[model samples]
Target: MLITQCQQADVALLEEHLPSPSRTSFHAQRFARQGVGTSTYLVAWLADRPVANAEIRWNGCAATEVRQAVPNCPEINGLSVTEPLRGGGIGTALIRHAERLAVERGVQRIGLGVDDDGNPRAAALYARLGYRPVVRYLDRWSYTAHDGEVHDIEDPCVFLAKELTSAPTPDLGVRVQ
Candidate 1:
């Protein structure tokens, strides 16, 4: 297994695993354009093939509800392990990598949202990684299911957060157990 920063060539590979909003080509382009700002993207490769992905970002107004609760918390924007690789520990590995990235970037905390259905295992995985529920914002809206919807829209988006140590680069001291 190898963890690598994404390049232009891997844009499509990143897209395949993103939620619908990121399926289009330019989404990768835009994310790449950010080049490690409040948000950045990463790909987890297994034996030369992209098998998992994660996104790390600074908490901002776009995350108004999240910010209101955990002010200035850095966010784990997104993460996913391909279906075939789901139970092989790839997601956990990717998330741990993101935690390291957050610590390296001087971020003192992390946040993310998951669906209410409990179908997406990221919530459970993050829980194991020291993330705890900080806030839960209800989205009183609905949407049609299409081929490329990116963010979660499970009526109410459940927000989770974790406090991170900012002193060291590559710190994985975060523990949920």
Candidate 2:
């Protein structure tokens, strides 16, 4: 197994191997482009094929809104391992790789979200990796619903995070949950 920063040439390979959410070409391009200039993504391969992937972002997106609401937080983006290889530690490898990159980039902490019931396994995996849940929210219609009316769903999505390196000047905005 080899872990390396993703390249444009590796995009199609990643698309062919990862599952639905991680397979799109646009994201592959984004990751390859950003990982190069920005150092935000890392891809894991086995036998020369993409098997797992993760992204560590300086900011949070919708999944990380709760943490953003809190204060200071470093947001982590997509983290996934191909379904067929789930129990084999690919996810852990990808996360650890992201951690190394995050630490190198001077980030003090990192955050990510686990989808409601839909991704329970991912939540458990993150917990095993020392991530703690700091916030929870309901997921209404997901990409198309109002926050006010979205409050009733029992979706229970969770935001989890881990402190990477403590900064000399504490950014007391938020602590990873």
lDDT of 2 by residue, 1-177 (tens): 677766778777876776333223544655754765643666777777877777765655444457555455655666777778888877776676667667767777777778867887888888887789878865343221332332233456777878875432222221111
lDDT of 1 at 93: 67
What lDDT is reached at residue 162 by model 1? 75
TM-scores vs. true structure, each candidate: 0.74, 0.71
TM-score of 2: 0.71
Off by over 4 Å in 2: 19-26, 32-39, 70-72, 138-156, 166-177
Q: In lDDT terms, how accurate is model 2? A: 0.64
For all predictions, the C-alpha RMSD in Å is 5.4, 8.7
Model 2 sits at a Cα RMSD from the real structure of 8.7
Candidate 1 lDDT, tens digit per residue, 24-107? 454375366457565666777766577776676664424567778888876665576778778777666666777777777777
Candidate 1: 10-residue stretch with minimal lDDT: 168-177
Question: Candidate 2 at residue 98, lDDT?
Answer: 68
Candidate 1 — which pairs collide?
20-148, 20-149, 20-150, 21-149, 21-150, 38-58
